[model samples]
Target: MNPQIPDGLRELLALAAGAGQAPWRTLLRPGDWLLLLCCAALVAASYPLLWRGGVADRAIVKRDGRLVTELALNVARKYEVTGAIGTTVIEVQPGRARVLSDPGPRQYCVQQGWLSRANAVAICAPNHVTLQLAGRGGAHADYDTINY
Candidate 1:
């Protein structure tokens, strides 16, 4: 018939309620803000590292230190560039470019893999071929004297 909680149980409950409770700022602790700040800084710094292809829409292929071709990235196609060494096969996709094959000794350009980010380059030293990603924005500015 006793509806009231026992004295010891009530006291235990009161202590339990306050034991884990603290001010919001105090609960965060001293080093937690530093960790939070570092995490926030990391996320902020990663924004620029992310590749954006809005204006970086062209794949330019250079042969023998000269610009041989510039292809729009939106158009999917395969381009062959003949240089002093030999022909290089460049495959272009939307916002990306890569060398399918090249007449180089080590095939380094093919190993360099795809170029989707602005200002990224794949160079085949033996074949004298270089492919670079370009943007139409102010910084990129339509070739901007890429000089191979």
Candidate 2:
């Protein structure tokens, strides 16, 4: 049997092999370091928000123009669904009820789930619906206060 080789295959192979021998610093530029730092800072800033429940409030769920259920949570659970008719389940921790609904395809709303604290939301895409938790209508005057 005869073996066929492409014209530039030898040069390409040599280049690839040489790459592994180069100093590691040659592969990382200043921009790469900056990007790594920025990502680290972003993750650091988000840790508290993601792990420590920021607030607490009542979460109301509605489906097809009717209220289905309500819950309270320390944080929202993220989920997704897609179909003609779909069901959304909301499980609240520390003594809360689960809200379920039938939503059509493009379950964007299901992705929004429940955010027990600030910067959290539940959304249903196909139905163009959302479920969220917020503070009571009145009686609050603290910037860092969280309602349990």
TM-score: which candidate is best? 1
Model 1 poorest 10 in a row by lDDT: 139-148
TM-score, prediction 1: 0.57
lDDT, candidate 2, 1-148, per-residue tens: 5476664897788777785576878899999999999999999998875544445466655555456555555454523322235545556654222334535455554444434454344556466444555444322311321233
Best by lDDT: 1
TM-score of 2: 0.35
**Lowest summed-lDDT stretch of 10 residues in model 2?**
138-147
lDDT of 1 at 17: 82
CA lDDT of each prediction against the hidden true structure: 0.80, 0.52
**Global lDDT for candidate 2?**
0.52
Candidate 1 lDDT over residue span 79-110, tens digit each: 99887778899999887889999988888789
